[model samples]
Target: MASPALALIVGTLFAQTARAATAWRFEPPSTSPTEQSGNYTGFSNDTINDTEVVEGKVFNRFVQIWLENTDFDDARTTPAWENLTSRGLLLSAFHGVTHPSEPNYLASIGGDFWGLQDDDYYHIPENISTVVDLLEDAGVSWATYQENMPTDHFYGSSYTSHNYLNASAEDYTFYVRKHNPLGVYDSVSQNKARQGRIRNFNDFANDIVNGSLSQWMFITPNMVNDAHDTTTDFAAAFIEYWLFPLLEDERFNDDGTIIVLSFDENETWDVQNHIYTLVLGNGLPEDLVGTTDDTFYTHFSLLSTVQANWGLKNLGRNDVNTTMSNVFDFVARETGFENTNVPEDARPLLNISGFAGPLNSESYIPFYAPDDLTAIGAGGQGVFVSDSLDTSVTYGSLGESTNLTSIDSQSPWIVVEDKSEAKVAVFAKEGNGAAPVTTNMLAAVSAAVIIAAAVYL
Candidate 1:
């Protein structure tokens, strides 16, 4: 028989172990490579670029975070105390609309698709209210930390490759400048005008190091750094790099803040229709780690959260239903932050009635051509082709030989994994140097392909 003292000691040890297990620390990754694919056509270049540029920074200042990192057990791994989980809130500003950058960023905060779509930065239209207005109205400080934003203004007319484009929309930056005039500022020193809220991506890094910024920040990486036209790994690397220091900040450890990572929108057309979104915070449940929230959400939902957080009035329509109340855990805790009280067994509102089947099914295929492509590339005139591994597979158009490879490359469509058939369209040459173009050819396929990978990190 065991002695009473031994039994008591065993129970005490078990309790201690459980307590220790409950304590955890979340630090941003050390090196965020601009790689990692998402649900789209062939490679996820845009995803990779976004991650790297947004997060990349000076090594000296950020290194201090890891050098003085600590576990969540209230133990002092570093003397200065850098507990990421408790102090920092990750506020990721996603560029939404389509794979192209500018419209996506506008959609992320504005909650509406601006008139001019596609990633192209030319022909910017004005008269759009942005989330910046809302954030400013609420007195929540915010800035755009773009990796290589030329001339500070979104429409500085650099005509450079700094723009992140997709097979669909190209040149995303100019739209932001056109839509939000408030972002333009007059430089008294130079006796000229410059962008107001916009700053170089590197400046954001300096702000993080200097602690000169506010509670909310928006980051946009350069063309290569932010995965605008690269792979998903690039984006991931950038995020991890920037996030590590913030999570390690001593102030964030003491105060409760939440960080979020999300994609603006998935590929132009099909496959998995959902985008990626991640939340990192000290108050979040530990069990929530490496989990997927496959809830049906639109870009507007993100806008709703920002609106609520900053006390912005609703934008009406779809934006009204964009509350994240369903996904967050609101139950109050010892930490004096607002609790989210989300249930564990909450069912996602997947539109199964609208959704047919997985990509592999014969009947599950979607209309790869006119419908999807038109939605993505309708506003512009260009041919774009995908980098699908299978040469036999064709999306959007019909006839392989006649379609101009040059035009096909400009086709404005999201690559759908499961397409039942292809469609095409042809346009006659017009007066303004517009050449006669033909698109919408069909090619048969043997199997279905899915572009999405389920990643839990």
Candidate 2:
């Protein structure tokens, strides 16, 4: 094995090469031809880029670039967005599943967000499966890239980067764990192999040049770049500086790849969860270029589209809810999957935020097991139920379970301490079946130990 001195020299050289290729300034990233290597990796052994050549019915690669909290009108009217619309199909009627950022992001991959309402950190129970589980099952490579994340598999709440724009600048909270969807799920965060796949922008640069890009990628820019803490204009410019050039690179976007550019949720919470969305890549038909699709699509559409394209199992939640999660029109056409047409009046109030769900509020309920029997996916596969799921009861029946005696215990939104440690589920012992109580701290560490031992050992 190489000594520490040798490692340091190699690291310094790689960083220098990455800096030169990216053409860094006091701004967002630019295009790079080869490896964009840096200290942004998780473990030295982490597989940030797990590449595979899986063929799909429609697109082989699916890349999701997420911006934050911009209304559909605001994004559409932005001068910077205009430049991007001409290169791909504009999804005029696309909507976010819920308000705030985290839930919609979770919904994008895991079929359902499990009712958690705010940006507070919380990990979904392991029994819940995600797109990563499906992809790996089907041999489709996937990974997530957070722009300014301190490390690849970081599970922290937030990190400030004084060196974001320039070294002399005051450190700012450029990265937040709430925005990184996979980090919120225990199945992903706790799994060593999968956790290593959570990389940063620098790794993205490295992945491209190494010819190691994954087939499925979820890319989240830093707070300022994603408009979470900045303006849509700033985000548009960042995209123009970064993603715009990559659109031309076949490694980034080929005829077999589909790139989704979307906002996490709309700024206007009063309106239905309408958000600006764009679909690009050479995978898009030439005839569809610069055109508009008025289909009623949601974040879950991406989930359905990917599953349909790759012939994978469904998570059996909103992803299978045809009315709520319609497949992309072009993808539907190619895959022989029919897109759902919901009447304007019959649509659910998507603007509805925080009605209390799993791991949400003070009266938090147990995570539900999906009904594999009914969750039929567009790929013609049933739901993929994990071994850890509690099959003794029906899904979402926690509130009615006889194990809970108190009225407070029956409530779905359980109150807990507001501390910011990683949220986890503590399965409380009942006279009968167990009920889950979520607490970040101010609870038994032994319970987690017992649960961990029970689940893993």
The most accurate candidate by lDDT is 2
Q: Which ten residues in a row have the lowest lDDT in candidate 2?
A: 400-409
Model 2 Cα lDDT, one tens digit per residue, 239-315: 87788778878878878888999998998799888888999998888899999999999899988999889999988
Show model 1 residue runs off by greater than 4 Å: 1-102, 115-117, 122-127, 157-194, 251-254, 282-292, 321-457
| lDDT values, one for every candidate | 0.33, 0.74
Model 1's alpha-carbon lDDT is 0.33
CA lDDT of 314 in candidate 1? 43
Candidate 1 C-alpha lDDT tens digits along 1-457: 9999999999989986775564222222212222221211122111101111111111101110101011122221222222322333222221133433334444455433332234332221122234454444444555554444443443342324322333344433312232222232112111122134455434444444444444445554443334334334444444456555555564332124445555444443332223444456543445554443433344555544444333444433234432332212221122122423323244233212212211112222321211122211110112122222222322322222222122232111221111234322222223333332223121222113222100100
TM-score of each: 0.44, 0.81
When summed lDDT is taken over every stretch of 10 residues in candidate 1, the lowest stretch is: 59-68
lDDT of 2 at 129: 87
Best TM-score among the predictions, by candidate number: 2
